[model samples]
Target chain A: MDLDSQEQILKLSELHGPSQLMVIIGAPDPEAAEITAETVVQGDPSYAGVLAGAQLGLDVYHVLDESISSEVPPEVWDAQIGVMGDVLEADALVAAVAGMRQPGSDSS
Target chain B: MLEGRYVIALGERDGISGPAIAACAEAAGAKVVFVATECFV
Candidate 1:
């Protein structure tokens, strides 16, 4: 049984890893997200690294843009991979702020 | 022909909108720029 799965995965590093702070106004689409991920898989195998079993924080951002909810669909990616549901930068900032208020007070 | 981030600026006005995207895409040298009316995303 020779599956030869090597050619299956794909990569999109150029499209991936934009400045994390990038703020765009676009719609959310899970199906489109999967299509894009699949495109990466078929186009470049290393795309697995960009978005594997779980899509990285960056992948989530690209699949949709909710900053302009009034103008775009609120839940184009409502279910599926669940990428649109999470926002990492907000979490990181919350953690950073909480760390500042911690007892040890590592940095001022 | 191009690389790095590209910003596409267009006036919301209709008359100038027709050729706006093409001009920007060419100037930026992107292979393609996905565009569709997003009356709903």
Candidate 2:
């Protein structure tokens, strides 16, 4: 990664104290999801810490279904089930929905 | 508040809602370690 990216990661890493783990879930493009995940995984002290002490871990989950719309992807159900299982095991859960605007909705 | 805490973020990748939520979580002191998104195609 570049220096800018590394700096951002470092900033994010400082947010968590000890004994902290976070799980993020979203859907649509897998690449974007992975990027976000890497930010935490590679930014955390435990995962990327060059020091001696232990570090925390970040868990990322990318769903294939769109939660904002009524239509469901063919494989989303299974993915949801699996993600739910992971959520239950996580210390905390966060739902990141980028664009929540519905179809045919006014932008104004 | 969210210091040393775990969080789960859920949303879509088509717009600003997903990332916005994640940003909010982080702003609230929650570490967004994981990310999952639904396919728009």
Candidate 3:
């Protein structure tokens, strides 16, 4: 996004280490948001599943509902929704890579 | 074992550490939150 936001993300990424990756997805309703999170967490090719499949070596955490409010920043949350929506709609392998790459660029 | 602690384990999906950590957390009377890069299909 902006230079400051980008810098913030990069700085936070460095401070947090590479082991954790958090994605925040928002929906029209809390229920839908939670469902989306559950899908990412529990789906056959879940967020974690796709990352492992790609050998990314990073842990994936899905933030939804109250977790979103507590855990995600507004800008990064918006970026995650945009990226995750694309991932959910596309082929698993390709989307996974794209999903992994988005945060790396935008956040990490 | 993390007793009375809120534990968040970051682990690899292809490995057993995530679940093992969760189990250990449980045994230690800790609340566990597990996040992983991948998981078994």
Candidate 4:
């Protein structure tokens, strides 16, 4: 990582807060990143912060991580209930599509 | 029977897996990413 990249990561790390988020790259496709970016742009804070940290302009190297956290203080990630389970703390979404009815769930 | 919530796959060790996640996100009105945790053993 270079100095500019380092700085951006630091900034985002400060913004992301505590409760480390695990962002999965999923298939190494640029589309995934784009979806993430789109989510950040449209989503609220919960999913925004973490997603912000993982924004890799052109390269995946452009992400916030421990390397830059040292220069900043850990914050708390305020996770919110997006359209569904897609949280800002987790930019990489993993959904389990169940029908409107199940054994023990809310479908009202 | 109800289809319920579709279960997308996320790789182990907090790494990337298949495109399932992205697909789910798009389907679930995800602007960025969605999360679905399930265990199949």
Question: What does the lDDT read for residue B20 in candidate 3?
Answer: 41
lDDT per residue (tens digit) for residues A1-108 in model 2: 223333433444466532354444443333454444444444423333432131223433333223211132324433334344343322222233123212232111
lDDT of 3 by residue, A4-107 (tens): 32233234334554344333322223333333333333332333332222332222332222322234344544443334434332233223323433243223
Ranking of models by DockQ: 2, 4, 1, 3
In candidate 1, how many Å is residue A99 off? Answer: 28
Q: Against the true structure, candidate 4 has what lDDT?
A: 0.27
In model 2, the runs with Cα more than 4 Å from the true position are A1-9, A23-27, A43-57, A63-108, B1-16, B19-41
Which residue pairs in candidate 1 have backbone atoms (N, alpha carbon, C) closer than 3 angstroms, thus clashing? A9-A45, A10-A41, A10-A44, A10-A45, A10-A47, A11-A44, A11-A47
What ranges in model 1 sit over 4 Å off? A1-15, A20-108, B1-19, B39-41
Chain A TM-scores of all predicted models = 0.19, 0.30, 0.27, 0.20
Predicted model with the maximum lDDT: 2
What is the fnat of model 1 with respect to the true interface contacts? Answer: 0.00
Considering chain A alone, report the TM-score of candidate 3 relative to the true chain A: 0.27
Residue A47 of model 2: what lDDT?
Answer: 37
* CAPRI quality level assigned to candidate 4 from its DockQ score: incorrect
**TM-score of candidate 4 against the unseen true structure:** 0.20
Q: Candidate 3: which stretches are off by over 4 Å?
A: A1-108, B37-41
Clash list (residue pairs), candidate 3: A48-B38, B13-B38
